[model samples]
Target chain A: MSLIGLISFIGTIIIFLLSKKVYKKMNWIILSPLLICPLIIIAILLITHTSYSDYNSGATWLSKLLGPATVAFAVPIYKNFPLLKKHAKAIGLSLVTGSAVAIISSFLFAMWIGLSNDMVNSLVPRSITTPIAMDISEIIGGEPTMTAVFVIVTGLTGSIIGPLVIKYIRIRTSAAKGLLLGMGAHGCGTSKAFEIGELEGTYSSLAMIVAALISIVLSDTFFPVLQHYLVG
Target chain B: MYMKIIKIILQIIFLYGILLLGDGIARLVHLPIPGSIIGLVLLFTALQLHIVKLEWVDLGAGLLTGELLLFFVPSAVGVVQYDQILGVIGVKLVAVIVLSTIVVMACTGLVADSVQKRGAKKA
Candidate 1:
């Protein structure tokens, strides 16, 4: 392997090792690998002035694994089928309402602040996963790359702070909590849901999948109408 | 152990095939969403219909799901490449993210609570 590849490998190993110790001291709730990794990269970039391309070249192999990882979510959904069936109506309703509100609220907020159309488009799919968010960004004339960043930021913040929000509000059911986190926050929230319990994780994963689908369809149909009536 | 590895490899190939097929259909029909999302929806539908057994796909999917955050590293790394653009739009980006997150969380929480209460009433 090349030097950069070796460095990336070693870096990941180090993070994995540190994670164990960190996990012991902090609740998995507070210290997420998701939140830590980017900060590590940023710190490295700032200190070493290492080019992003060099780091990405080393990291791309791991990144490509995302496709298979996303596919892997199917396992939990399958395992949780019984619970899902029991709560089918509640899950379905939450997904629809949560997704609609997420899209509309984000769009309105973007408009309220008078962001450019491209910037607004980037903001449109902020709650969805990267792949879906990128597609929505392109269709709406936003920069896909920026949308990806916004998606990660949105996910990370949601995942990290989501539980606190839930606790403060005193929302109790596993299904309700998971669906809200998953729909509003995507992968990040799903991870947090997983940390809470298997049941929460399962619902959160299902919610993430459903929310992404709902957001894509809503954006396609509603964005144009929004543009005509609100933007124009 | 060897059998498990082989199974995972097969599952990956199967999922990729589904993604490609979905992409092709989307391209042909000019669908707004990407082929992969369509593939995911198709897969979910197939699972619900019992057309495809979940047993074979479960292990691979489970492994992948736990490590989902790692998948975003590439794109996140890509952000570092656009330091100038980010610097220019940084405030707007932060505003959009922070504001949207609060809105999404609040709205989802309200909707979920109402749905749960409705479900409880029926039960």
Candidate 2:
């Protein structure tokens, strides 16, 4: 790689590590590495007059690792299969409903605000985890990078308001709470679930996996039809 | 220590192999879904069927997922390019995402909670 590429790559890792430290010390969701690390990297690139292509030459290497990491998701899903089976009905029905609502509501909201089809497609996958969400965005003719931004912003929003929703709604069941966070926010929500309890965390993660799978299946089927009618 | 490192590397390679297998299958079948997702399902099924043991991939998988966010940085940072698109409607877009998040949380939590409560009562 070129020296510029190397700088971008190394700079990302260093900033990520430091940002993780800051998040730990502050425990503030706003300071999350997912939110700030990119902000810092983008600022550096702009200030240095470095084009994204130059930075990406090296950073793309890290992004490629996401493919294998996506496969790696199976380990946790497999480990938690028993739990998934145990609460099959509740998880199944709710995730089906939740995933449907996620897509439908995103489309409605995006359309209500007069966003184009592309932005709606991107926003539809905003509720899922990043890698899968990005994949879905590409599949449906949305900009994956824009979807990534929407996904992170969605994560931050959901995690921030998730606790307040739980409190005001008087949700007492850990399973319900976990499903709410995971289905609503994905990874950040799962982390928030952990802070509440282990069971909440476990269920939250399970919700993310199942919700993602369901959303994928929906993307191939329901999503296109929705787009045809709504955006067409 | 050396063995541990070797094991991790080998497991990662194994995972990569599975990812490639997924890509091959997706191409062959012309599936609409992404191959990594196909690989995820395949791996999960293999574990369930005892065709692939969990220990073989556990450490490497853990390592990858643990740093998953790092993998997303390049793509997310690419958002900088879309500044012009986001500049005008950014505020409205953020509001939509926030409002939708609240709606999603409410619907999911309420539905799940009621279903769970009914299940508990029936038991």
Candidate 3:
């Protein structure tokens, strides 16, 4: 087998093993690849001198699978239709508001910090999942790859701190917790929400779908105008 | 059991078709959103509009959701290559993630809670 293929196999096995162990331990932060994998890889690269291109040569195979994986998300959304229907209005309102805030706040903050337009556009989609965020970043003339990094970091942060914030604020409803986390943070937040309970997971799943939809709309509509203004 | 398998396979095909259609629309219009995401939105819209029955895709969608984490593996691995970027931007990245998440959660929570309470009051 090729070196890339060999690495892919090993990477899969390691991820599988770690995922199982982390799931069993119920350690949302550690169990999540969004948090653990990046930290581990960063540590490896920092200690060693491996180039990203070399790693990506192997990792791209896995990356290609992202599309199919995303297509598969339809399954979950289908399964939870009843729950979604029950909270449709609430979900809709929350998704629109949450998505707007996520992109707008990031943009405003990036601007305040005097980061370049590219950086602002990259950060605008930080709250969305990587693939979608990358597309948005590219459309807006930001570096898709950099946007991917911000997406991962955003996801990990959401997964880690999401639940704690819920508890701290005394938000007790599983539905509320899940919706907030998923809408604001995407997959990582959904994973953490799942750790709390099935109700939380269900709501998180619904939120994830809704958030994706809202972000898509925003990327197509609001972002283009923002991009034009920033670039011009 | 055979029927279930066939249904799952068919649903996958339909989902793929939706993704492609969305992608085509995006390309034609020069839209920023990818086809898959457009497909997701379309699917959700269809569901809301009752154009497609939820039962048609339930099983497959369930399986996908269960393993959504697996899909992120490849990109997560790329983090291995970004060590230097992580070092220089690590603090900023961390700040962004931490602050953004908190702000999102707090804001969403406030909105949802107040909305629910308002609905309750009207009820």
Docking quality tier of model 2: medium
Q: Rank candidates by DockQ, best first.
A: 2, 1, 3
> In each prediction, how many residue pairs overlap at the backbone (N, C-alpha, C within less than 3 A)?
1, 0, 4
> What residue pairs clash in candidate 3, if any at all?
A75-B60, A75-B61, A75-B62, A76-B61
lDDT of 1 at B17: 74
**DockQ of each candidate, alpha-carbon based:** 0.49, 0.62, 0.40
TM-score of chain B of each: 0.85, 0.87, 0.77
User: What stretches of model 2 exceed 4 Å from their correct place?
Assistant: A129-149, A159-170, A187-202, A216-232
Model 3 stretches with alpha carbons more than 4 Å out: A1-3, A26-31, A38-55, A216-232, B1-25, B28-32, B41-60
What overall lDDT goes with each candidate model? 0.75, 0.84, 0.70
**TM-score to native of every candidate shown:** 0.86, 0.86, 0.78
- TM-score of candidate 2 restricted to chain B? 0.87
Candidate 1 TM-score to native: 0.86
Put down candidate 2 lDDT per residue, A1-232, tens digits, no spaces: 9988898888899998898899889988677677788999989888988899999999998888878877887886677778767788888888898999999998899899998878788888999988788889998889887888888778767877899899999998888999999999986787678668767876787788788989989998999999888767
- lDDT over C-alpha atoms for residue A7 of model 1: 85
Q: What is the lDDT for B100 in model 1?
A: 71
B85-105: candidate 1 lDDT, tens digit per residue: 467466666676776776676
